[model samples]
Target: MNILGLSCFYHDAAAVLLQDGDLVAAAEEERFSRVKHDHGFPKHAISYCLSEGGITAQDIDYVVFYEKPLLKFERILSSTLGTYPMSWGVFRESMITWFNDKLWIKGQILGELGIETEKLLFVEHHLSHAASTFFASPYKEAAILTVDGVGEWTTTTIGKATADWDGSGENKIDLLNEIRYPHSLGLLYSAFTAFLGFRVNNGEYKVMGMAPYGKPTRIEDVHKVIRVAADGSFDLDMDYFSFHRSTNRAFSSKFEQLFGEPRVHDSVFYTPTTHPNGDHPDWDRDVAAINQNYADIAASIQAVTEDTLLKMCENAYDTTGSNNLCLAGGVALNSVANGRIMRESSFDSVFVQPAPGDSGGALGAALYAHHVLLGNKRKFVQEHAYLGKQYTADEIKNTLDNAGIYYKHFDNDDVMAESMASDLNEGKVISVARGRFEWGPRALGNRSILADPRRDEMKEIVNTKIKFREPFRPFAPAILERFASDYYQLSDAEKLYPLRYMLAVYPTKDDKGSNIPAVTHFGGTGRVQTVRNEWNTLYHSVIEKFWEKTGVPVVLNTSFNLRGEPIVNTPSDAISTFSRSGIDSLYLGNYLIKK
Candidate 1:
């Protein structure tokens, strides 16, 4: 049976195809559309999945949506009503958007896919998040935690799941408890994200990146906005928040009073900690002092978020009594929080699938239908994140030739790996676009910009010259799985699924932080991606060759895209990025293009 799962009309719109319970293809619409965080109907993504699966929409037996639209509409309608006049703008906009399109999502899907009404199914949002993690996990049974911005009505859910790998038992996901809307940890953090001069959904990671530059001095002030209980259930002091009522603002004037003033968007962010030598280009003491306050706010929120997640994990462990935990939802993308959970929580192991946000919900919906709703035994484990579309060698070559680009072709993997390794050793930055693009926000090895991690200056070179991103944003250390523990404090490195997907942060060993300064953050932690040969042979071989040459088992890795753009999807996309950026070389399949 073929199932087509979809998540759309919200950020990170995506589509996934499953055949006989195994994921065939998955992709976010932004990849093809070139619109960062595209939230439209994922028709392009659906087309790609269908093409990759070698099947048309007619062949799909079922079409499942990630969430129930009616339930979400109900939440929006009721919340606006409860807040009344203060929410008039939100209510008016919501009515127009919902009545025009969102309320008719079922009809849209049916028409788009040419499927009958009976073939369409809808899963609850949080349930989709739960299934996305638990079903993809290798665990037979595990505790589940899904936390994100309000999903329909729920903001957080703690559950236990059981998978029937051998068909002896039934597949199940029982979400035991939930926290509802207007009192969400995700939104609370997002409020701080906006206050710190970052976009809500887009710039939350920037806040995470900025947090390490300052101490959590404003944590007490942050606590005034939200209160957490012993079991991790919490309520927001609504007077400080405007997200429930306003369309433009997430926090109220009172919140500004409590946290001082919000940071101006797009302003330079440099603190004394960032430039201990006082060498910043626009170094003004007053500006640096204000930026430090913003950084402190970022740190305070990050600390509270990590602590809350820890408490929630503890509660999930106590309630479910499971040694394993599966995490999904946008908040699950917080590598710092994930690292804390792994170290401080009661669970012995944690599994987070490659795409843990709304994009993953598409895969979750398909998995939920195939495994639980249809009573099928589990057969698929997401061992790697190479589930997206991949271009053949001829396709890559044709694109290069068409673009009049000079290139070299190598048939042997070892020769190409050695050549790339030599480039890194020469301090040349290379953008690699080989095999399938990753399913989630992380680049992994398939679509990554790689550099030598030994030089601290490579951080500035890659950030300012190649990526044109924030200087403070840390690069991931893509290390060979066996050497992960040698650099970062990850024990049994091969067994941790989050490490495979770059979903967990761990501190560099006390003696190893200085060895790879480019990838190590201000906090001394690295969001590590452990590469095994079986999962990505060429990527692993390149890192191994670099290790042989430099005596370091890691490479500085960032997504193969410019700032504000989705990661490159096609050969043309890769070439365009390479042509526009300061990347020294481009690797497309067996072909290499030099600047």
Candidate 2:
């Protein structure tokens, strides 16, 4: 059976194709369209999935959408009506969007793909998130938790899933409880994200990364905005937030009074007045103080989020009586909180789907339709994230030749890995665009910028010289799976799956981690990716070769794109990014290019 799943008209639009309960191809629209967080119908992504699966729209047996339009519209209408005169502007704007696009999603699907109305179906938003993690996980039974911004009036859900064999195996998911809209943990975080001079949704990670640098002294003030019960249920003080009543701002005037004036969007981020070497001549004392204040706010919100999520996880454990947990939703992308939950929560094992955001909703929708709705047995588990498109060596060479780029070609995989490893050892930043691109926000190994993690300066060099982003944001370490336990303090290393996807942080051993300062953050923790040979042999071999030369067994890895761009998709996209960025070498398939 060919199942086509779609998530669009919201951020991170994507398409997924499932053949016989196995995910064949999945990709986000932004990669193909080169538009960050594209919210239109994922025509390009849908086309790519169909082409990748070698099937047409006519061949698809079922078409499932990520969420229900009617229910979501109801939530929007009711919230606006509840706010009354204050929400008039938001109501008008929302109605325009709903009438033009959201309300007609079913018809739009039919018109776009020529599919019959009967073949199209819709799943609840949080259920899509739940199914995405539970079904894709390697667990027969687990406690499920899904948290995100408002999804059809529900913001958070705790459920239990069990695989039962009744002649055929089927995974059954029952939502035990939920937290409703306008009182969401996600929107609260986003409000702070916007208030901290960052874009909502886009800059939440920036807040997480910036937290380690400051103290959480303002957490008491943040308590006024959100109230959490012992059971982990929480409610937001609507008076301080304007998301339900306005489109212009997320936080109200009272919020500014609670915290000081909001940071301007164009202002500079934190920079220390005195460098480690000596006093910097051009350092501004006032700007430094402002940046420190912003950092404190970031830390405070991060602490509150972690505490709230911990309470939720504990409640899920208490309600379900299960040790295994499956976590999904955009908020699950917060690695710092995830690490805390892993260590501090009652659950022993946690499974987080790589694309926990809306993009993964496409995959979840198809999996739910196939395994849950159609009564199919649970058989497939997502072992790796290389589900996107891959180009052959000839195809890559064609792009390089057409672009008139100076390059060298190698026939052997070992030689290519060794060559790239050598360049990395020399402290040269190399961008690799080989094999299929990653399915989620993180660029694992295939499409990644690699550097020597042993050097402390490599982090700043990559951030400023290559990525051209914030200097404080830390890079992740891609370590061989065999050596992960040697470096990280993995309590349950045998069963942990979050590290495979870089979904959680782990404290590094003082003895081993001190040798690699680039990937280690200020708090002695790192978002580590444990790479197995079975997952991506070439990429693993590169790290293995680097280890053989340097004895570090790790390399610094970041997404293979400049700031404000999605990871490279096609070979031509790789060439374009390589040409403009400070990347020293480009390794495309078996060919290599030196700038």
Candidate 3:
């Protein structure tokens, strides 16, 4: 049976196609629309998935949405009533949006796909997050955890899953418990994100990146806003937060008073000019003090978040008594926290899907519908992030030729890899677009900008010249899997699968990592993707060639996009970005382009 899964009308809209329990294709709407977070109907993504599966809308046997709308509406209605006059403005605005757009998801699906209403199905939001991880994981039985911004009524869930024995056997998931709305770990982090002069959802990672630079001096102040228990369950003071009552603000007056003043958005980051103890005349303590303060708050929140997550994982372990654990949802994307969980938690094995956020919920919804609801046995393993649509050689060539772009064609893969390896060794930044685009927020080998990780200045060059992103934001490393441990300190090489998708951060070897300054952060950790040849051939070969040339098996790798843009999906998008940016060369399939 063919199942179509959709998650949309929220950030990271996406569609997934599953044919006989196999994930055939998945793509995010933002990739096609050129919007960073397209939260509208995923028409383009749906179209691409259908085309990739070689089927029409009528061919789909079941259509499953990622969440239950009416249930979510109920939560909103209750919260609004509970808060009453304080919630009036938000409640009024929410009702109008829901009535006009959200409540009509059924109609939208029916109208868009020309399918019968009976064929459509809905899964609880957190269930989709849990199913996405547990079902996609290699473990037959594992403890499941899902945490994100409020989903319907649940902000977090702890569950258990058992795989089906065969096509006729029983497959099941039991949700042991859940934490409800207005007390979300995601929203708590997002509140800090906004207060730290970053966009809420978009800038949470920035806070994570900035944390390692400073001490967690404000941790005590941060605890005033929320309280945590020994078992990881927690509650927000509510008096310190305004998200429950107002759309315009996330934190309240009490929160501001506790943390002093919020940072002004888009202001310059601060650092002290001299040590306060030493007599250094003409040092600007006034100018440098606030930046250090901002970094300290970032560090404090990151510490609290990691501490809370570790508690949650321990509680999950104690409850389920399972050595294997599966984690999903937006909060799971915190690589630093994930590293801490892996190192500090009782679970021996942990699995997080490539797209752990809402985008992956589409796949989870479909898997949940097929395996749990339909009683079908599991058969697929999501081994790589190449599940999105890919362009054929002809399609890429046509786009390049039609654009009148200057180009050179390589005779074969060997020559292309060798050429690129030479460019990277010479410190030339190059954006690569080959095979399918990655499915998640990370860019694996296929859609990445690569540079020599060994060069100290490579970070500044790529950030300013190509990415146009923040200078402080460190790049990730795409390292050959066999050589990953040489540069990174992995606890267990046997359970290093999470590193394949850049889902975990690892401490860089002190002697080895300092040699590759571009990828290693100031905290001495690197978000690394371990590339195995079987998963991606050309990518592995190029890295191998680079290793041969420089004896360093890692490259400073980042998403192939400019700041505020989604990773390029089509050949045209690649050419457009290449032409506009300061990248040294564009590797589009076997062909190359230069100014």
Candidate 4:
């Protein structure tokens, strides 16, 4: 049976195709549309999935949407009504949006796909998040946690899931407890994200990156806005937040009073810690002090978030008594919190899929229908994230030639890996665009910019010159799986799925931090992606060759795109990014182009 899963009308809109319970294709709309965080109906993504699966819309036996639109609309309507006059603007906007497009999602899907009403299905949002991780995981049974900004009426869910790999048991996800909207950990963090001069959904990671520069001295002040219990259940003090009542801001004036003042958006962020030598071009003591306060607020919220997640994981462990945990949803993308969960929680293992946010919900919707709704046994495990479109050597060559680019061609993967490794060793920043693009926010070597991790200056070079992103944002350490444990504090690193997806951060070994200063964050932790040869031979060979050339078994890897853009999807897209960025070299399939 063929199933088509879709998540749209929200950020990271996506589509996935499943053939006989196996994922055939998956991708976010932004990659194809060139709109960062595209939230419209995923027409381009759906078309790509259909083309990748070699099937038309008619071949799809079922069409499942990631969430119940009616239910979500109900939540919005109720919330706006409860807040009354203060929420007039939100209510007006919500009605216009819901009436125009969202409330009619079923019709939209049917009209777009030409499917029968009987073939249409909708799953709850948090359940989709749970299934995204649990069904994709290798574990037959595990504790499940899904946390994100309010999904319908729920914000967080703790549950237990069991899959039928051998058909002896049944596939089930029992979401036993949940925290409702207006009292969300995700929203609490997002408020801080906005206060720290970042976009709410888009800039949460920037807040995470800024946290390491300062201590969590404002933890007490942050606690005043929300209250967390022993079991991780929390409630937001409504007076401190305006997200439910206003469309423009997330935090209220009361929140500003508590946190002093909001940071100016898009302002240069530097602190004494960032520039110990006081060498910043715009070095002003007052501005640095303000930036430091923002960093402290970031740290304080980050600390609270980690502690709350730890409590949630502990509670899930105690309630479910499972050694394995499966995490999904946007909040699961918090690598720092994930690391704390892995190390400090009771679970022995954690599984987080490459795309743990709304995009993964597309896959989860299909999987839920295949396993639970259709009674089909689980058969697929998400071993790697290379599920997007892959370009042929001819396609890449055609694009490069048509663009009038100078290039070289290599017939063997080993030769290409060796050449790229040599380039990286010589301090040349190289962007790799071989194989399929990754399914998540992380590049994961397949679509990554690689540089020598041993050179500390490469951090500044890649940030300012190549990516044009924040200087404080740390690059990932793409390490060979066998040697990951040597540099990072993760035990059995090769077996951990989160490590493979770069979903967790771990502290570097005391003796190894200095060796990879470019990839290590200010706090000495690295978001490590463990690479095995079987996953991507070229990527692994490049890292191995780099290891042979230099003693370190890691390369600094960042997404192969400019700032504020989605990762490149096609060879043409790659070439465009390469031409625009400061990358010294570009590798597209068997072809190489140098500036």
Candidate 5:
């Protein structure tokens, strides 16, 4: 049976196809459309899934959407009523847009695909988040926890999953309990993201990365704004926030006054006079101290999120007695937190689906509908993330020829990897576009700019020379999976599914980190991508090539995109990215473009 799952009308819109309980393909709309964080309907992605699954719309046995639109709309309207005149403007603006497009999600999707509306089923937002985590995880039975911005009514939920022989061998996600919205870790981060002169939803990672640089000298101020209860639960100080009050946000004028400033826009960093680096010295010890403080605050946030979440996980574990734990949701994207919980949590093992964010919601919603809702017992386990499209030499050559572009093909894959690895060893920056696109926010090795971590200037060269982004931000290293435990304290790596994306950081294990000046962060941590040989052979081969040349066994890898752009998708996209940016050379498929 063919099942189609969708998540749209929100950021990171996507679709996933499943056949007989196995996920066939998943793609984010932003990648296909080249729009960063595109929230529109994922028509391109849906079409790609349908085509890749080799089935027309009618062949799809079920259509599952990530969230219940009507329920979410009800939440929006009720919140508006609760705030009354204070939030009326936000209500008006939000309602207009919903009426204009978002509210008709089922109609829009069915109309676009020419499918019957009756085939569609709406899953609760956070339940979809939970299912996406549990079902895709390696664990057949595990405790589940999910946290994200308000979805329908749930902001955070804890559940349990068990393999049921209930007449047939099938797994079911059973709910335990939840923490609802108006109070959320994601919202807290987003609020601070707005406070820090960054875009709220998109820029939260910037805040996480930037926090390592700023002192939480403002922690007391944050406390005054966000009250913590004795029960280990918390509530927003309400007076300091405006998001619930007006489209403006939940913060108040009085809140900003205590915090010392309002958020800064991205454009301000572009201007000569207000350039971010020019304003602050590259490495102020105070800034370094601040960065450390933010890491601790990140520590605190992770601590609290885990503390509250464990309450649910332990409950699920005790009830199910499952030795494994499965995690998903936007919060599951927190690698640092995941690492900590792995060390401290009660579960014997854990599995995190690589695309744990909303992008993976498409996969989860579809799998839930296929196996659980449809009563199909076929069990499908995902082994890797190389499920996207791949191209051959002829296809790539044709694309280049159609574009009237210049290129050269390599005689052997090893020679290309060796030559590029040699250049990296000598400190030359090279952009790699060798394999199929990765599924999530990370580039993996396929669409990444690589550099030598030992070269003091390599990070700056890749950032300023190629990416054209903030100088303070650090890049991740794609390390061989075999070498990860020796470098990082990933003792439970067996429990966690492989993470090709640089989503999380692990402290160096000598158990201490080395003086790899470029890749290691100020906090003595590095975001490492563990690449196995089976999943991405060529990309892993290139890393092995770098190791042979430099003996470091690691290469600095950042996403292959100009600032404010999505990762390159097609061959044309790769070429345009190469020509437009300061990338010295780009290895596209079997060919290389050297400038």
Candidate 6:
């Protein structure tokens, strides 16, 4: 049976297609629309998934939404009532938006596809997150944790899964327990994201990047202001935060008064000359220090989160005594903290969805419907991330032709690889848009801008020469998996988290002066993406080509986009980004374009 998964009416609206429990394709709507964090109806993404899967809307047996509408409505209604007159304006605005857009979401689905409402099903927010992990995982039964900005009523949950396939033995799922909302790790992080100069939902990463630069000098003040309960549970002082009622967040006037002053995003990233020491620090070194500091905060908060999760896991493990663990939610995306949980926590093995954020919720909801609700089970494994629409040679050629672009097509893969490798050796930046688009946030070389990492100035070249974004932000190294451990101390190889997609940062051999100095970040860590040949032949072959040409097995790989945009999802998006950026060449499928 074919299942259609959807996460809509929310930021990063996305769609995923699953056939007999195996994911066929998944995509975020922002890539197609060119609207970063586009949260409207995912018509473009849905169509792409359907076309890629070679199925129509009518062919889908299950249509599942990521979150439960009723549960969320209840949370808003209750919270508004609890606040009463003090929250009338907030309540009115929220209710109006819900009434105008969200309440009729099912109708929107129907209107978009002409499907019956009966065919549509709703999964609770956190459950969808859990399913994304467990369903995609190799483990049969494992501890589960889901944390994100309030999803319906659940902000975080810890649970377990068991044999849950259907009577036909085609599909299956099972769960244990959950934690309700008004408390969220993601919310706390987002609150801090706002407190910093970055945008709330989108710029939490900037805060993560920036944290590695400053001394956690404000830690004592923060600890006092943000009180931790006896059980390791903490609550933000409501007076400092405004997310529930107003969008301004914790960085209000009172917040500025508390702190010396809010650092403006555009201005402050450069000027704070003296760190807590007498040393001269560039962005990476300074940021590295800050990363260590943030890692401590992340480690501290994550310690509490893991402690709660461990208790929850132990309860579930005792009942099931299962050796596996699965996780979802935005918090699942925290890889540094995840490394700690994996090393120190309760589970023998763990599984986290690569797209553990809300985008994966769509896949979870659909899989849950097919396996749990429909009573069918089929063992599935997503060994690779090439589960999105791919352009054929002709399609790519046609796009380039229509655009009046300069181009070249190689006679053989070997020649193409060598030439591209030569370009990189000469420090030429190339935009690669080959094969299918990636399902998650990572570019994974398919939609990546490849560069040489040996040259120290290449990072600046990528920033000023191509991306034109913040100069300090470093690029990731797409290294061959065989060399992952040689380069990074990525714990266990067999069950290693897929660094192939560039999630977590690992310390280099020389923290300050690593081999790939260009890709290594301010914090002396590289967010590495390990590539095995079997997963993506074209990308791997090109990397091999570069290696053969330059004797360097790694290339500086960042998402094939400039600042403030989603990764290119189509040939059109690829071309547009290529035209805008200072990339030296473009590789769209078999077609290559040159300046």
Go through the candidates in order and give each one's C-alpha lDDT.
0.93, 0.90, 0.89, 0.92, 0.73, 0.73
- Model 1 off-target regions past 4 Å? none
RMSD in angstroms, all models?
Answer: 0.8, 1.5, 2.3, 0.8, 3.6, 3.8
Model 5 lDDT per residue over 1-595, tens place: 8888898887689888888778888888998899998878888988888888898888987889998888888988898889889888988998999999988887887888788877888787777877786777655567777777778877776677765434545667876766666777677767766766667667766655655544344555666755655433456777777888677564678876775455445522221211335344454554444344444444344445545555555665676677787777777776666756666667777777777778888888887776678766645666667666656788889988888877778999888888788878777888887666778788788888888887767777877778888766777877888777777767645445644556567777753356466777656678888887887888788889887877777888888999999988888888899998887788889888888
RMSD of 3: 2.3
Q: Estimate each model's TM-score.
A: 0.99, 0.98, 0.97, 0.99, 0.91, 0.89
lDDT tens readout by residue for model 3, 1-595: 8899999876689999999999989989999998888989999999999999999999989999999999999999999889999999999999999999999999999999999988899998999999999888888899998999888999999998889756544678888989999889999999999899999889999999889877999888888887999999998999999899998789999999898789998666645522335233434667567778888899999999999999999999999989999999999999999988887899999999888999999999999999989988888878888988889888988887887777899879989999999999998999899998889899998889999999998988898788888777889999989888788887555466678899898898889888899999986899988988899998999999999988999988999999989999888988889888989999998899976
lDDT, model 6, position 313:
50
Give the least accurate 10-residue stretch of model 3, judged by summed lDDT: 273-282
Show where candidate 5 strays beyond 4 Å: 164-170, 215-220, 227-232, 267-321, 492-494, 510-512
Give the winner by lDDT. 1
- Per-residue CA lDDT of model 4 for 1-595, tens digit only, reads 9999999897689999999888989999999999999989999999999999999999989999999988899899999999999999999998999999998899989999998999999999999999999989999899999999978899999999998989798899999999999899889889999998889889999999999998999999888988899999889899999999998889999998888889889789999989988899999998898899888889999999999999999999999999999999899999999988989899999999789889889988999999999988888999999988899878888888887888999988899999999999999999999888889889988888999999999999999999999898999999999998899887788778899899999999999999999999987899989999999999999999999999789999999989999999899898999999899999988899989
lDDT of 2 by residue, 1-595 (tens): 9999899887799999999888889999999899998878999989988998899999989999999989999999999999989999999999999999899999889999998988998998999999889989988889999999878888999999987444445578999999999999999999999998889979999889878877899999999999989988999998899999998899999999999999888366764521333244545777777878888899999999999999999999999999999999999999988988998999878999999999888988998899888988877889999988899878988888888888899989999999989999999999999888889899999999999999999988998888899778899999998888899998546467888888899999989878999999987999989898999999999999999999989999999988888899999999889888889999998898999
Task: After superposing candidate 6 on the true structure, give the runs of residues whose Cα lies further than 4 Å from its correct spot.
Answer: 164-177, 225-232, 250-254, 265-268, 271-322, 511-513
Task: List, in order, the clash count of every candidate structure.
Answer: 0, 0, 1, 0, 17, 22
Better of 2 and 5 by TM-score: 2
lDDT of model 3, residue 500: 85
| Model 6 poorest 10 in a row by lDDT | 271-280
Model 2 score (lDDT): 0.90
Can you rank all candidates by lDDT, best first? 1, 4, 2, 3, 5, 6
Better TM-score candidate (5, 6): 5
Which of candidates 1 and 6 reaches a greater TM-score? Answer: 1
Q: Is candidate 1 or candidate 3 better by TM-score?
A: 1
Cα-based RMSD of candidate 2: 1.5
